[model samples]
Target: MINFYSFRDLTRHTLLLSFIFLLFLGEANAGVVVGSLTENFTCDGQIYQTFPTNGDTKLFEAKLDESGLVFTPRLSPNNESIEVQIKALLPGANSVSLTNSLAFNPIDNFLYTVVRANLNDGKGKRLIIFRIDRNNVVELAGIPENNGTIIDEAGANVSSSGLVAGAFSPINNLYYLTGVRKPVYVVDITDMSFKKFSAHNFNIADIAIDPVSLSLYASNKRNSSNQLVQIEFDDINNPTTIVRKGNAAPISSQVNDAVGASYFTPAGTYIGYQNKPGKIFSINLTTGRTTVLANGPNLVFNDGASCPFDFEVDLDNSTLTIVADDAIADGVDINTIQATLLDVNGNGSERKEVSFSATNGAIIGSCTTNFFGKCLVNVTNVKAGISVIGATVSDGTLTDTVSVTFIPGAGDPLKSLITANPTTLVADGSSTSTITVQVKDSNGNNVNNGGDTVNLTASSGTIAAVTDNNDGTYTAIYTSATTVGTATITGTLNSIVITDDASIILKNGAPDAGQSVISANPTTLVADGTSISTITVQVKDVNGK
Candidate 1:
């Protein structure tokens, strides 16, 4: 009774297990700094954000935060890193490379993500959709066709897979993505594997969708000029009209270089985009006016896409009003609060003044916060049409500015950003330094009443106290710590983050015992079996730092 057939079954089972682990590898998401993401999304109850890490590599990952200040790329229940999970499921390819990606889910059982990468099969920039099932198993769902060539703007062949932006639609079961020097692609998610997505010859830098209409949009550049083009994709099979061709440029041609990326909020209240100088601009789909959110210089997301999260979708919900992204660590939530100052008056006047201030920014105004993150500003006596409204918020260490337009029929004027008096301070405990923060509008108008409260904190020292002068300025009189490094001073306007750094040097009180090490410059021997060396001596105060 040696059951010989049972042995065959056991061998087959072993092969299956080995095949499942063919790409057996995983890496822990170690120490990394996650910034104030413009937006983020959640899928299967897991949070994800995208940042241009490692020199502008647009990456999206399921990261988690235990501290509100930073986030660590998290490990899944299946013990897989993002790259390993993606590489294992690549279709018919030995090697895979992926850059930017966004998630799409039209069905409950499938998590579809469109990734930009070369699967080493010589197919240009492929928007490969990888589907993850309930068991955390992955498989390639399909590859959307790249409607353009692998050529750069210079007209020669290039190696880069210039896929830039992506958005998924539950309306047509499609994804709207863009590539450089190529057209906007409308890929059908429900299509068979290796099928082509319908392409609209709209060469644009980024693409976003109207969550309600599922319509596509792009700020396309032609002849060094940029125009915001709209695409209607009801058919999803083919397009009769070229969306970007012959369209009038939205702004001056000088704005061509300022075009960056785009994303629609879960509510689709507005479509947010970034300019070349790292500012986030929002175009109200209804009003078509631009609202700017000014950020740091390196805004790569700094170098990556600004819209990093595309969270879970409730296909069952008709409005597609699904989950939004939030970063919560312990009891603190460092979330991007997107508030829309709609026709706040309800009287529908075409002109109003809007002023913005955050509690953390210590800038208080006539405007106040409401339930929906909206600001109710007294628009009395304010001239209408695109008035500059400034919004700023900060934590102790990070500062952010949100640029908004008060469409004359809406709110009041803006407030100013806190300008540090000295911008730098020396940390030497007894020597006191005075730091002032002011609130101004976009027009450089001071709105501080001096009574505003400013809270100050330092990474390397203690901020004794902040005093309100009752003008628009708040001052913090601080004594530095005994350290010899830069101490960062952060002022929080409730949520607006304004910060400055001061380098601390050892105040030449007296010299103390120190040690020095000597080393050779070229440690490796040269061809003549000899090497050059250099030695330098240094001294330090009693404090090792």
Candidate 2:
């Protein structure tokens, strides 16, 4: 029994044990791996690891067995007294760079941290820049702090072109270092030239640029408190204390050890944080209302030992990555973990299904929600003639791929019909004539009250009064005064014109008494052709002759 094991079996067993030991040690040493992504293998669920420490030069690398993809992160060695805070990490042509006030580039294989001596003279305030290439080589791209004459030098920090999040001005292809402190600096990367825009008084923690609006949002953290202040970087660099004092959570409770970790979401709808417990909070930029989204075990803070220093969000994946310190004392380990994919597509069974008509300007239906979230946006305002109708469903995480189509049919064209009542009438002097016009569309539907206006104009007669009854009918009164002619009335409704003609005759003084004709000669003619005296003489002659 003592000599039972074969050499081959023993060798295999040893190799397996060694691999397991390496895996366990790697997990233990890697610290607080919060990042924009996590790789998932189809076979095993082992997460790739990459994290940066305050004063560590050896960049960590973790290789998973499933896909043969090597995940390596470059780190800058800890300069304890120097206190090089990693504000931003940008990838370059062949290398990666770390930046604080000064830029630090990692040597090949993350061997040693080096500063560009030519770029930084160690004299006036300077900004250092290093870029990482695809091969993971670090390159020092000189980003001078202030090469031009110093207009003001009070509370200014040098920024490089790589601050990727916020709005940038194309007028100056540079990075803006803005704060509530004195003499804010704008350094252009092209010429390595800088100009003092204005004075900033507070410590500028983070800067964000709104590309669409071309606005800058700078978040400031005061000395001792967790009170976050926001300043708008307009033309004048005006400071408006957005997060007022005593309104924010206590400094100890909110930011932990990492100050100024707060930033707005890309949409500027929410403000979130990394490296602090329950740091992600939704903020209404207008009202300054803050609400915590998801906060629990996953968001534990490192008390400076392994502080969650920086964070970024991959909106496409709906995942957030938080970078933290990998110090030994805090027991914080860095390992990329799979994101919990949440199927936000709500229950489709209970939804009200609708079908839209092929008619133009038809409203299919409307959607409303009690929760604030993005909806599926597939319906177009333009007409596609008779085409398939498809609905878009989004849960802020995933969108629907299925689309619905609507069949096309011949439809009536929209029209406004104007009909006038009393098509024909006889108009006379001192006679009241009323005209009523109704407006409807070609489909025999009454037009909306707010849609059209009706106007009645009379050419030959005077319109005494015009009244709009709001039921698409307009009453117009016409007064005829001695004008014996046809009174033509034109009704215009919604640009459609129609005319009605009415004939009027002025009789001789409104029919004489007893139908007798009295001329200017004071003689009244009877039914007979002779006058009254000739009638009396004829009656006497008829009796004699």
Candidate 3:
């Protein structure tokens, strides 16, 4: 009893079935369906495959095969890994490094591969560079720095020197390149004029840079084992300290050294690394959990373990593209939720709190938006039933919300978010800021959690009181005595974290809002009827503006 249907038809049928099942379960009374969401794609019109187990679920990648189009699987390691397909092979070029010397610039949105000229000059080895994209590939020229002395043994090419590791820094927006023994090179993407970083003596094996946190992670092998370390640019523009994180993986009595490294920008906190044998392993820094997401063929780095792995992470869409069909966006246990805040003009809204809570599951994550009026949150403890989500947003004065529900059937159910409004409030003296929260689900439906517990806290301000709206909504009243300071309010729904940052302005009193119009002495001055009467009026302000 097999009925064949097209991929598009299958998707519609699946959604239809899920909708029917949800109706029988009965909607929660606490949740009110205020509005519906129509925008499903990201700001760039991209879609994320959020752990949908069913066939024909929206996928982030497609393979161009003879069959026309095929969706790629994420969790299965038997298939190809994501990074292998994205690495642009530069052997087609004239002179490029045959080694793993590639980096992806999140700002420039370009993939660059480094190669050294074959000349045997001790210092003036011209740097051969290539900037690659999907349709166009251009070669760029760069000159290498002498760095006091060039280590010929660190050569990546037949020439005296080579590029072994490279990464992009979100802090200074600079591209960092390094060899076995040469000092770290910081090259400005625009000017390409590069300089060595602090003239360090350590020979970095490979490097991974977190785009959002701006932390530099590098590894060097000690006695056949690898030691993972984090480099902090206390000044950002300058490197000051290095903190060792011990072994990246378990250092058994048996030797195991991690070689290649790449940063996953969408998660903003995890790294894809490989030790001996080149199997791709993703390590979650937030949870301290590591899992093998992809199996590798015979690939080797310096100690016959390192391999070149590169892929593009679109933070807005939360998709890993340009990788092979074997990319694993599914191994992510962190729930990356997204919410769009808008104003009356239908533009991106500001200073909003976006939070989610499931009626029968655990919620996780907290985030705020930039000027773009959007945010990505990671949620956990997802169940296969209906989930409620809430949000609150303010324009530095007042706040509002949108609550909805989602039926996450074997997939993630949390969507949307917002933040505390009126982030800036007047200091004390009978002044209070009201914090409001709204809940919603992934499909834009609203669900009630029977006055579910919503966690709230503030860093500098006092949360004097809180009131539950009884309908998946709550308000926290806070007053600050500090003259000039900022308070950060953090809320948790189940496990999902929602945050709001507010500023308190200290003043003698509120300045004059406007002129107070004084009434005339004669209530009804009848000038035309019988007698003409003089009228007196005055205008005044609290500050006499």
- Specify the highest-lDDT model's number: 3
Q: TM-score, each model?
A: 0.40, 0.34, 0.38
Query: 41-113, model 2: which lDDT tens digit per residue?
Result: 1211111122234444323333322223243553333322111222222211112233222211111111111
lDDT of 3 by residue, 58-140 (tens): 11232211223233443213232212211222222233233445555554444455544433323333454444332222223
Q: Can you write out model 1's per-residue Cα lDDT over 1-545, one digit (the tens) per residue?
A: 00011222333234323322322211111111111111222232232334444542323332211111133443345765545566644444443444343444433334444455543434444344554443444444443323212333455432245555665555445555556555444545544212223344566656655555556666666666556777665443344444333342264433445354455544443333344554444455555556453342333431122222233221122110101222211112222323233222111111122244432222224432221224443211122122222342221111223322221121012343443444444444555566666654343435434444456676666666677777666777656677556666666654455443333332423445553344565566567755555655455444433
- Regions more than 4 Å wrong, model 1: 1-51, 55-81, 88-95, 99-103, 106-112, 115-127, 131-139, 144-163, 181-185, 193-201, 221-226, 234-260, 266-270, 273-276, 294-372, 377-545
What TM-score does candidate 1 get on C-alpha atoms? Answer: 0.40
Clash statistics: count for each candidate: 48, 44, 41
TM-score winner? 1
RMSD of candidates 1 onward, in order: 32.9, 22.1, 29.3
- The 0-to-1 C-alpha lDDT of every candidate, in the order given, reads 0.41, 0.33, 0.41
- Model 2 stretches astray by more than 4 angstroms: 1-54, 57-125, 133-136, 145-172, 179-182, 222-230, 233-266, 294-545
Displacement of residue 495 (Cα, Å) in model 3 is 45
Better of 2 and 3 by lDDT: 3
List ranges where model 3 is wrong by over 4 Å: 1-96, 119-125, 145-159, 171-173, 198-204, 238-255, 302-545
